[model samples]
Target: MALPSAVKVFLLTMNRSLGHVRQVEARPLPPRNELQQSVLVKTFEELFAELRQKAAERPEGSGTVAALDKGVHFIGKKVVEEAAESWMAAEHEGRERTAEEISQLLYQAQCLMIASGLDLEDVYRHL
Candidate 1:
């Protein structure tokens, strides 16, 4: 399946950040509308690499698209809310509950990034 250009650039850029590749600047981002097929991902890190490409590439007027159209502040609020919930879950909940809460937090984080024209590589670079 084709990863949206945003995701690919994020991954390539992140790889460079880990010194697994050359500098991020040398690996240019593709145009926003570009699309390219990705290799089958087989690990959690690979799978964890980015937002689900399908979700990122969902059609206009789809529920995700509609929510995203609400703007970054809206998504940012959800990200904030989810982050708090994740923290609560980690402190007060069991493993499964924590996992569930983190999944939600992660999704909202992705929404925030997407809405802001950011991506997973942005998160990694901050580390």
Candidate 2:
């Protein structure tokens, strides 16, 4: 069936107007609050416990400071795993996926800090 010339022109005009309206309303996005201090604390505690176990398992290292370094490798392993998960999430779509992946990454990082006898407060203090 052949369409009327007037109808075709009206449809084209409307499409053009909608494109312009969208362009005019386009703006930069604000930074999202993906993580917060309270969330960090909770995740940090969990990671810390894991780190403590790793450290206790390897008590061969001398003194407090020296022992801290022994578990660094273990923490490193966890961090690497978290990084891979985060990368996977980033490759996929959706805010929730990224959030969960980032949460894991943060948790592993906290584990590393805890292995070194550090805490969330220490990071905040340094910041």
For each candidate, the alpha-carbon lDDT, in order, equals 0.64, 0.62
User: Which regions of candidate 2 are displaced past 4 Å?
Assistant: 1-70
lDDT of 2 by residue, 8-33 (tens): 33222223534642222223322334
| Poorest stretch of ten by lDDT in candidate 1 | 35-44
Q: Which pairs clash in model 2?
A: none
lDDT of 1 by residue, 2-114 (tens): 66566555334334445664433234545434523343223334433444553567666565666677888888888888888887886688778887787777767766677
TM-score, predicted candidate 2 vs. hidden true structure? 0.43
Model 1, residue 105: distance off in Å is 0.7
Best by lDDT: 1
Per-prediction tally of clashes: 0, 0
Q: Any idea what lDDT model 2 has?
A: 0.62
